[model samples]
Target: MKFTFFTALILLFAPLTSYSLSQISNPNYDPELAEKLGADDYGMKSYILVILKTGENTSINKEMRSNAFVGHMKNINKLVDQKKLIVAGPFGKNNNDFRGIFILDVSSIDEANLLLETDPAIKEKYLKAELYPWYGSAALSEYLESSDKIWKVNP
Candidate 1:
């Protein structure tokens, strides 16, 4: 049997269409887990995304900068312990001058700003924090449990 262009296209898209339909009517859907994670119908929720950047206080004072960063790390751990920060990491050198990012599990930008105030880096002007509202998977924080085990040494 010879396949036409239309037949080939239909065959290529058939699986994707069925897969999409299956996902919408997922048999593994768990209502209890959705409630626990504060997930909406799409298994997603709102969060605060913070972008940390180099601040105006570019003082060459090594000791002060070092101390501020030390405090920054401690503050991150504290926030993680409190289940407020879902994700945190530094970005590689970039033209945007972006230093780092934090996906905070907070309801609003005001709340995220309040928590950032506790960070010495932001408080001391060593770093600036920019917060934005984000919508993402509700199960994002669940990966943290396994993350701790994978890291052999603390950075």
Candidate 2:
């Protein structure tokens, strides 16, 4: 009887030992913000997925892909100077699902779309861009810094 009682007591106390400092007494923990923050600094970073849909089973050659990349880089550089794009690059592997990915700090989806629409690659049917809102630990900090300006640019 005593052994069974002790076993139950041990089990009850075991969970308490596993919690670290982060799990307790974090007054800065904002439930709303915490839920939004992802593993990456997604909140401060806007994720754009560029899907290249040329045609059915039509693969873009290396030279064409390289040209498309150059076009994207040129436009992305412009946006970056305008404080829109943060980072842009093609996915390391050719997964065929997406042509590339870009991280930006734009105000809204419409703004992002507008910028994307101007890309030669998109205009030439080389790619289509999809924008998704992201959140992360440092996102709130970044957002606070730029609070004077609106972040959402959708119409």
Whole-model lDDT values for every prediction: 0.95, 0.59
Residue lDDT tens for model 2, 39-131: 232224334433443323245587876786578668876876675665565665555666566665555777778878877677656676666
**How close is every model to the real structure, measured as TM-score?**
0.84, 0.48
Clashing pairs in 1: none
Reference-based lDDT, residue 110, model 2: 76
Question: Which whole-number lDDT from 0 to 100 does residue 27 have in model 1?
Answer: 80
Superposed by TM-score, candidate 2 places the C-alpha of residue 48 at a distance from the truth, in angstroms, of 5.8
Return the lDDT, model 2, position 58: 41
Give the winner by TM-score: 1
Least lDDT summed over 10 consecutive residues: which range in candidate 2? 37-46
Off by over 4 Å in 2: 1-69, 94-96, 137-155
Per-residue CA lDDT of model 1 for 77-139, tens digit only, reads 999999999999999999988999999999998899899999999998989988899999999
Whole-structure CA lDDT of model 2: 0.59
